[model samples]
Target: MKKNLLMLFTLFIALFTITSVKADDKPVKNNYRIASDSLFAPFEFQNSEKKYVGIDVDLLNAIAKTEKFNISMDFVGFQTAVDQTQAGHADGMIAGMSITDERKNVFDFSDPYFTANATIAVKKGTKNITSYKSLKDKTVGVKNGTASQEFITKNKDKYGYKVKVFDAADTMYASLGTGSIDAFMDDEPVVKYAILQGQKFETPIKPEKIGEYGFAVKKGTNPELISMFNAGLAKIKANGKYDKIVAKYMGNEASDDKKVDESTMIGIIKNNWEQLASGLGYTIALTLISFVLALIVGIIFGLFSVSPSKFLRGFTKVYVDLVRGVPLMVLAIFIFYGIPNLIESITGHTSPLNDFAAGVIALTLNASAYIAEIVRGGVNSVPTGQMEASRSLGVSYVKTMQRVILPQAVKITIPSLVNQFIISLKDTTIISAIGLIELLQTGKIIVARNFQSFKVYGLIAIIYLIVILALTIFARRLERNMK
Candidate 1:
């Protein structure tokens, strides 16, 4: 009986030891956040269902699956993706990003998954642009932060062409269509995809292999992720999945579906109402939330401007001046991209602000500055005697200011506040620079897919006009009520 008990005890110890070792040896599971370009078609783009589908999307997802890893993808724009990865907000990026020497300094790239050439595309049937020399005296367009832009800018002196940099490919393509730019340089596959989708453009110049596309992580970070990507990519390629994904997007078979006439305003709205509504919702939400927060903060600062303490007043003045002095777009970028980078560098910790939070903070700061001035102006407009009378009647300073001064100041500031709200609403469009899909960005996306810039932009303008008009009427009614 004693021998049997000892044997059972030994068996139990062996099982426990084996379990502990296996647990320690097992790889930790992590869901990595990956970023990619929002509108690079055939590489990444929204389908009719509003779902993102493309070669890059499929390829990355396949690799993740094959490697038994998890990932969440953010379809931010190319420049924004690079910013996010550098800021450590994203674990990696696979946005058809070119692996270049300059980029190598900042990013550790996986093995090249695809190679693409930069090509000069001119409006169709334009026989003049046969070579780089033929581009002399022509205005050439390139998307911001692209290898094509780098190449074009470097050779612009020799080519004798003026360079126009667009923040997005949609605008660049639109410029080419409207003849604002004589030609544009873009990835060959992107240009081909655009042509396939009915873009009236032709590449006359021979394409130059700028660089091969690779999955990248920030240097000295996520080395394991790079290894996993390389391994999975090889597996996919070996098993023929890579070729299948490539063929799915870049197949020789042209689409046979009839093109809808989205040129008409009504047609454009009909086709894009879902996206428009989603965008409008975000715009309104951002505007309302930011304005409310700004109002609260601005009122406090405005009171500071009129405070008994000279220091408080001076602080308020400086803050208002500082924020108001900066452009809204710049503020958005700084908050969204710059702040994260700053935080990481100083603390060695990654802190990334999402688009919504960053946009609200930027808009609030900007609007608060103006709102503070309005409040100051309103408070000053009130009679000084009222404050004295309230204080003489045994009211404390806070009570007197709240009951006597602020009530009247609010009435005086109503119109200005309403105007500021309208401005803030319009300003939300600028927040799209940071990749928030507000109304204007939505319109840009639609224009990219359909190439109907005029109709889409016109509709967006009309929507803004209607909303502003309604707000103006509401403000008038509110003023009358207060009177």
Candidate 2:
């Protein structure tokens, strides 16, 4: 009787275990992934407490809570977030993205949550730049791809001003302060936030035509996600959560002041140490890897250019000329965004090049051309007698070039090579075009959050100077050792 009773209990336990396992294996119903800008103040920017707390952040969280769905937020930059959403890597985006007809073709958007307008601002105490009429014969700045750019481009002819498009707000503001640009246009809230944070700028023009901000997803991919977002947003608004979020970040500003003051440069650096350090690491890694690749390519092509065969020399010439002719910025954009599309068109395969890898490859290609010329000059600078002596010593042509000529050429070109590396390091700033944030981009992110462009840029300039100086010192030591 005891044995029979134990067997029954074991059977019941097995059934229960099977039922629990099946329940656990059920798929998650409505998990959505979203992307937002890393810094776009009051809409989305990191606070002094190091938390990503702002209007967008709070609103998204509230929406997810009301909808009973899990959300994962990826705080990549604006361009990257758009790229990922279009590629279907993220379910949606809500980075204070302005809704426009052009964007609607590629992305489906939720209901408009906010509206904003572009405004013209200039440094204080500037002369005769009060209105659009005064902007004639002046150079104005606008952020790339923004409505401000469109506004400036459309009206530039009428205003008789040249427009310069910048990638980031901080850079644009810096240009205004330094007189590189006479005036600039950006969103009213952004400019107001900058002023509130002590940026020495004044908005002389009223807000321009208004645009609605919306959450977006890739077109025709996730209708359910959009529905959920819209439903939750409506619910949150009805329940007063939306109003609270807006007022929390946008109102009672003096009570919740956290902008960095003039004396807090050190504090800003200390507060954002992790971001800066990560950026430095990426910059160093990019520099070292790209330099190494450039060195190898330069040496090979340098040899080819100096080869006895006419065909080999011609090949090297065409390559060097073509690569050198194209601008680095253009080449980088092509490699990062265009290559995948080109590949897909030709082969019907969607292989997007890794952003960092594309950057390194572009840098390597550009630097290699210049380095090839340096290497050739270095080799030619060597006496012809050296190669003759090596050949007379029964050394093969290949061996003589490698064992006798190349080493001397490399040593002679060491200073130039180091300089080229430094140039390459600085050129990494342009790679931010394709969304790889190195040191400069990192500083831009911090400045966008804190609105302390002068201090942040000053600190970035120091960091860059220190790094290049260290490289210069090392090069000098190397030259001395060689001597």
On TM-score, the candidate that comes out on top is 1
- Stretches of candidate 1 above 4 Å error? 1-28, 254-263, 385-396
Worst 10 residues of 1 by lDDT: 252-261
Clashes of each: 0, 0
**Reference-based TM-score of each model:** 0.90, 0.82
For residue 251, give model 2's deviation from the true position in Å: 0.6
Error of 2 at 66 (Å): 3.8
Clashing pairs in 1: none
lDDT of 1 at 250: 80
What is the C-alpha lDDT profile of model 1 across 1-483, one tens digit per residue?
Answer: 999999999999999998875454332557899998888888988765567888999999999898888999988788878988988888999898989999999999999999979999998999888999999999999988889988999999997999999988888898898899999999998888888888899998889999899999999988878878888899999999999998887876533212555757887877779999999999999999999999999999999999889999999999999999999999999999899888878998888888999999999999999999999999999999999898889999888888899999999999999999999999998998887889998887776666678778989999999999999999999999999
Scored by lDDT, model 1 comes in at: 0.89
lDDT at position 463, candidate 2: 88
Best by lDDT: 1
lDDT of 2 by residue, 1-483 (tens): 999999999999999998875454332456677878876777777676656767888888888787667888867778778876775557789888889999999999999988878899988877688789999999999987777788889988998999999977778888888889999998887777778776798987777965888989889766766776788889988989898888776664712336544347878777887888888888989988999999999988988888889998899899899999999989997887677767767887557677799989999999999988888889999999999999899999899998889889878999999999999999988887677878888887777777678788788899899999999999999988876
As a whole number from 0 to 100, the lDDT of residue 127 in candidate 2 is: 69
lDDT of 2 at 190: 76
